[model samples]
Structures are given as C-alpha cells and as structure tokens.
Target: MTGQPLDAGTIAELPKVLLHDHLDGGVRPSTLLELSDAQGLVLPADDAEGLASWFVTSAAAGSLEAYLATFDRTLAVMQSADALRRIAREAVEDLAADGVVYAEQRYAPELHVSGGLEPQQVVDAVTEGVEEGVAAAAGAGRRIRVAQVLTAMRTGGNAADVARLALENRLRGVLGFDLAGAEAGHPPSRHAAAFRTLRYASFPVTVHAGEAAGAGSVAEALHIAGAIRIGHGVHVIDDVVLGEPTEDDPWGVEKARFGDIAHWVRDQQVPLEVCPTSNVHTGATPSIAQHPVTPLLRLGFAVTVNTDNRLMSGTSLTQELAALVEHAGWTRDDLRDVTLTAAWNGFIHHDERAELVEDVIIPGFTERSNGRHRA
Candidate 1:
C-alpha cells in the first residue's frame, strides 16, 4: 500500500474514489499562478513546477503549522464567489481526468471571506462548481460525482457558523460535516456546541483527528463529535501493540487486549482516510514503507488511501496508489480492494453509492483485474 509506478494508461482508466482531499489544498498550480497573478499576490514561486514544489515543501516537508499555512495563500485568492466557483469546478474537472469516479472535497469556508461572500455563497459556489464539472466530465466520458464536506476549523471560532453552513447544504451536494485544523491545541471538544447542533440535525460527520494528535484526539472525535470517518487516522498505530518478530508469525504481536480508542475505531469499521505521501511529508509517519496503513490494511480495517492535498503533497490518487503498490508490495487486487472500500465508505447517498460500487467503481476495477475492462 505504499509506492507503485503502475502503467499510466492503467491508472487513467481505473476508477478511483477520494474522500479526504481539501478543496483549497488541491487547486491546480497553474490555476493558482493565474488567479494569484490577477489578484496581484506574488507567490513563493512563479511557474507551475516551482509552485507545485513550493506547496509540497511547505506542506509535506514542513511542520503541521507550516503545512497549514500553505492554505492561506490559496484561500487568499479564493475570496470572491467567482474565484471559489471556478476553482471548485476545475478541482472536479482535474479529479475526473485523474480517473476519480467520486470525490468528497472538504474545505474550511471561514478562510475565504475577504470579499465578504456569505457562508451560503461559499456552499452555493462549490455545489454549482460540482454540477458544471460533472457535466464537463460527462462530455469527456469520464463520469464523476462529487460531494462537499464542509469543515469548521477547530482553531477558528467559527465552528458553529460552519456547522450551520453544512446543514444548510445537506439537501444539496453537501454530504457531511467535519472539524479540521491544528489537532494539538484545538480538540473536537472545543466545538461541542457545533457537534451537538449537527447531531440534532441528524447530519453525518467526519473529523480530522489522529494526524497531528494521537489517541486522545481520536477518542474525542468519535465520542464527542460523532465522526463516522476519520481523516488521516495514521496515528491509530500509537495504541496498537507490536512485539518482536518471531517464527510462526514473523510479526509477533497482539491486538492489545485492552483496545485503545483507535482500535475501537477499526474494530467498528470506521474508515481511515490514509494519505500516504502527505503523511510522510508531515512526519505523520517515518517512511512510506513503515506507514501504519499497511498494517491497518492487513488487520482488515476499512483503510482507504488518498491524497490529502494533491497540490500540497505533489501527488494524485493514482500516484498515491502507485506509491503504495510499488513500495508497500500491494498487488493489483489490493489496489482494487482499497478503491472498492473507499467507494463504499465515502459520504454519499446509500442508493447512489451502491450504484457507484456495483456499476462504476467495482465494474471498472473488476473488469480490469480480469482483463475485461482493458481496451
């Protein structure tokens, strides 16, 4: 599940699903260059490759705080409704081209208000963008569907407002609510009211925990915040028991009889959005070879791989899969399995999602694995 250089044609034709990518974090570097230029905002870099490297260096190779700071630049130019809509549309278009059949893109709307666009306008722009992008994809025979996950920055004081915005758009393309930001100081408990409000509305929710923080933060996300999905739950390994290697089981260890909060998450089938490259860049894990995702996958956890920030991480879902396959020793079957699991576990309608699994995602991958989908 770590590093694979799969055939480019295979990757392009294979159906994929993404659940944890950030709307602001996945912007096209060229789009960033053009938008920032019009806004008279000088970037840390000028060209696409430089801008792309700048994002990865800032996000993957930087500290958690520094990784987050990269968003400020993207959000700064996305204040206007037009800008937000354009970026969202293009985000979907780009994902579709990468062979993504479904993606649930999340963003903290609190950061995009310099132009005084109302919170509703932010949701509207994103939903409109999805519609347009889906149409464009259909025209190209890619066929992609997207849902927006509205995130409230736990460090920001607008959790309640963001929660409201997510609720308002639930009837539209908004599928869930989430709290994202610095996981250390800003725990999910800090936004108890926002979680409570969302709960009252009977809305589904996911939380970005266990990345910057460990077991304690994950506990609060599930127990207090009702997070059905975990964003970057790589730190779940912290609670696991790993003993010395032995003969019978080369990896001699026990699933701690005393299950930690993270174990409960896996045992209970809560999906972890495992972004391998982003995890490495942020020092969430020491190396892709040692990523907790491989172990988690073996343990039968609902582990779904993703590119948490394509632009910032300098990766695509295909690259993420390739990395996992080549480095992590994942086979073609393993790739299809993860894609299917992600398709099932993503925040979409049960009926629509069922169709996605049986029709688009499963069929495409299944046919490919069997050589039937190959052209």
Candidate 2:
C-alpha cells in the first residue's frame, strides 16, 4: 500500500488501541434485550435493531442531560453479576473483531451493586469476563489485551471508596481510576477528596471534563483533580484562538493561538481521549466534518481518537476511523499517529506500552502498507 488515505476495510484491519471506552455504554443491543427479558423489564423496543436505533436517536437529543438519560435503561439491565460479566466479555469480543490490540474499558462498580453484590465482587466478575473473553478471542486467532478502569460517578459520594477499590484490584487487571457522569455543575473539585486519596496512593486518574462544560472544567480536572487524561475534552478548544488569514500564510497557519490551559495541555503532552461520533451525538459538534479534530491534530495537541460509548454512538472504532477518513480527510499516517499516541498514554506499564508499539502497532501497520513502513 502507498502512503494514502486508507479505505474503510483496510482501516478496520489495522491494529487499534482504545482508552476511553465504557463497559456499560458498549453493551450489545442483543445482550441488552436478553438481560432485560430475564429481569422482566420493559424496554422501549422489543427487538435488538430497534433498541439500538432508539439508543442512537435518544442520545442525539441536543443536550448532555438528555444524552445521559438513555443510560437509565442500560444501567437497569446491569444489576446482576452474570449480566455484567456477559457485557464485559462481549465487549472484548466486539473490540477484538474490530482489530483492537489493547483497550481499557471503564465502568462504575458501585452502580452494579444494587442487586446486593459487593463492589469487589463487581470488579472481580468483570475482570474474569475480560480474561475469559481475551482467551476465547485468542483461541480464534485474535490477540488482544484488556484492562479495567474503575469509575466513580461525579454525582455520587463513593469516589474515595472506588479509588480504594481500584488500588485493591490493581494486580487483578484494574488499571486506573476515572470520574465520569455529568460534568457541568458537578465539577471535579466536588470529588477532591477522592483525587487526593488516589494521588496519595500514586494511582492514575482520568476525569470527564469539557464535554458538558467549558474550558474551566478542564482546568479544574487538571489543577484541582490532577487528571492525566481527559475524557471528551472537546471543549478545551474553547481556549484556542485562531486569527484571520494573512497575505504570507493565507490559511493563518502561524496565527493560531492557545490560551494558558490549552498551552499547558499541549506542552505537557496531556492526552485528550476524543470520541468523534460520541462528541457529535452529545452536540459537541454538529457533524464529523465540523469537529475540531483536524485543527487539533494540525495544531500538535496530543489527541487520540476513541469510542467513548459504542452503543450510544452506534459505532465501532473502525467506524470512528472511517468517519475521520472521509469527513476530516485523515490519512493512514494520521490514524497511525493517533493510535501510537493512545498506546503511549494508555494506563499500562511502560514496558507494555513499548511492546505494544514495537510489536503490535508498528508491525500491523507495516504489514498493511506492504512492508513500506513509515519512518
């Protein structure tokens, strides 16, 4: 293959790394129907396709609040350990099928404890499911690695407890901690205690900021909460200012300016876990063509594409890449760049990160390019 923009099929075959996926949000629609039926719960649609369409449409309701309300039905079906395990396992299988070599999926264990299981039990069940899924996929000739990121809802009071849970299970596939859910009024500072605890324990933390809010939310996530990666940080573009084109550079190439927050994020090499389809669904952008990904990538920000909620976005990592290829005009090299960035920023050990790049990513891309590897 030449150094050209990759088509959808070729893009699907390339190795990928995902850092911002959600376990609850990526549940299979068929699995949701099965779980709902087993629990005698009434769903908006009785069939899988209809249910999937419903989730996608409802999430496009133009506001983050409306977008998040769709999770109520999803969360309702996740009360049992068996349900959670199945969801986790199937998530791995789906991602592996899409050629994901590494993933760190997140979910709130506290949310799954409503049926009387302890938080630790929830973690163990999901971890077991991940391990089982990886083995099953490996049996079928697909190699993948998966880790868990325990999440604490920003509106809830169990963040510190969840942080401790993450530490307890660090050796058992738990990778890091995250603060998810509504981000407007429930700022990261609200969970300062949890951040302080995780910081003291030397645990890595990612915060959901600048999605439902503005750049200040990102600042609090960094300064107040000490987040290393930001989930859906599209709003950080609010801090970036672009000047009018001049005669010397008609596109204003050198006139783009970054505010203090954006400057810090870029200079510090902080990763922004950007989910293009999910961002459009949440009204962060009207469409993929209008997303700031192109400019952000050109501006040299550490941007890594992701599938934040596959079910909600009705997407796969491949679909996300394809959309960028078509709409944002991203090339094979651009996809490779972001995949490498994600692998580096992944919440794994340094040796594992190096191995992923040196072994899986580079080799896969090289094979796809017919041994004409990029320098």
Candidate 3:
C-alpha cells in the first residue's frame, strides 16, 4: 500500500533512524554565539538568530567546497574539550527530541585538536557528552541511542590515525569510521590505508562520494576503499539512463538502464545516506522536488533520508522527510520503507539492528498508522 501522506507533527513523532548527521554541523546557534564570544572569535553575526540566518545563506553557495567553508566558524569554536562535549551532548539531545531512536553522529577528530587537545581526548570529551545527552534525553522521556563515527578529512593525511582511534574505541562509543570533505579531486582511494585498516578489523566504513564528483568516485569508494555505505551518493543518478515515460510508469524507473556501478549498488543494496536539503544547499541537486532521491528510491535502491547539517540546511530529520512528502510525493509507506532500510543498514550488530527495527521502528510506525486510521 502507498499509505496516506503524514503531516509534519505526525512525522515528527515517528521513530527515526539517522545514519549520517554531522556533529559540528548541528551545533545550536545560541551555543555557537556564546562559545564564540567566550573564545574571542569574531563571528559575522552577533545574535543567535542572525548567526543562524547567516549559516543558511552562506551555505547555499551552490558548491560543496563553498558549502564546507561555512564550517570554519563552527570548527573554530569546537577546539576545546568543553565545546566538543557540549556540541556532542546537544546534538544527541536534539535528535532525541526530534524522535530519533537511533543515530550515528560523525565528526573528524583531527579537526577538533587545533587547541592542543589530543585526538583521544577529543573522542573522550565527545563520548562524555554523548552519555550525558543520552541520560538527559531519557530523563526527559525521550529515549534515544547515539553512536560516534570517527571521520578523517580526505585531504588530511591522518586517515590511518582516525581509523585506529575508531577501532580502539569501538566498544566505548565509536561504532564506525568515515571519510568526508570536498569530493571533487580527493577520491576515496586517497585514504586506502585507513579503509584497509578498518576493513581488516571488520569495522564499518562509510565514504563521502558522488556528491561533488560523479559515479566514478562512487565506484572507487566501493571497490578501492571498501565503504559499506555511501554518503551523498546523489551523483550515482548520472550512471542511470532513463527511458521514455509511458502510462504504466510515470518516472520510467522500470525501463531505466543502470550502469555497472548502479546495478551493483542496487543489486547489493548498499545504503545511500541522502540529505535532501543539504544536497540542494550544496548544489548537488537543483531542488527538493527535482532531487534524484525519489527516482533512486522508486528504482529500488537502499535509500535512507538524513539531515546532513541541521544548522546549515536549517533542517531536522522531521523537516527532511516532510520536504520529501510535500515536494517529492513521499507517502507513509515510503517513510516506513526508508526507515526500515536505515535501521537494517545501521553500523550496529545484526541483533542490535534487529532489536531497533522490531522493537522501536516498526512499532512506532504501526502505532502512528493505527492512530491515524482511528482518528
């Protein structure tokens, strides 16, 4: 069944699984202002509202590198252990409040050590914050689980170090490793050593590819670097050749021809962590209505919705799904399917992922569906 379209409030209450949120990108505006003032950092906007507006405006620069430049301010303030902890804690608490039952928040440890804090110290501080946020959210009647995915900047030559850190803290709070940054010139193979280290240890790895670049970057991420999940894989659409639409199929997804990489990705069911609004902001896609997410989803790809950056995109997970519903015609079943796919592909163990799906996600959707029917 296609199911009915869900309103924003109902969508907000649905149990969500977020697999690709950035820790630094979701910092509270007020917190950024307060921290910037404390650190004598000159921010473009003094007030929280102005700063929030500035982020959204600046991030809509129509390119990934330009979009990433906005992080300088956020990263500048995130040098201290206290700032990292506070940001991480607030990220978890915010996700929990938005009805996220499980999330993997990612950040590069190397970026946060500019203030002389060791990489290990950075992880420790964020872990403490995550624990605090989980406890606080539970106390507030919003139970959520959050895990860290240590990321290495593709240009930073420390992927191996980050992979080691993630492996060392696998049981602590870290669950995965990732490579993120400008995707144009820097391909995933640049960090092959790190991906190899993680793969040898059986650690989950997701690579940022096919966003600024094209499908070749995605192929390298999968074949060379061995990433289990692809971040912002919107450009994989380039490899797909669409056929003429007919009466039976409007989008022509059934008749579309997939290139080898696309066929492998779909046949193997590799999850794509798609951030709709963020894609628009980075000019990865023209707009939400025209985004490749809908076509990719209809084509039977393992697609999951995410808010890559809440502050920059001015979005939450709820808003991201709502946009898809309104602009892309996503229904309740579409939401449920993507949610289940995300839960199934989570970096957690098989049993834990099953528990999240069976115990949390499925029940949450069923309850909401029933409530709507009764109403």
Best by lDDT: 3
Best by TM-score: 3
lDDT per residue as tens, model 1, 239-288: 77766656644433443332567568877988888899988888888777
Each prediction's TM-score versus the true structure: 0.94, 0.96, 0.97
Query: Cα deviation in Å at residue 236, candidate 1?
Result: 1.0
Worst 10 residues of 3 by lDDT: 366-375
- How well does model 3 score by local distance difference test? 0.92
lDDT of 1: 0.83
Q: 1 or 3: which has the higher lDDT?
A: 3
- Candidate 3 structure quality by residue, lDDT tens digits, 1-375: 339887899899999999999999999999999999998889999898999999999999998888999999899999999999999999999999999999999999999988999999999999999999999998998878888999999888999999999999999989998899987778777788888888899999899988888999989999988999999898999999988878776678888999999999999999999999999999989999999999999999999999999999999999999999998889999999999999999988999999999988888898888784211
Better of 1 and 2 by lDDT: 2
Clashing pairs in 2: none
Show model 3 residue runs off by greater than 4 Å. 372-375
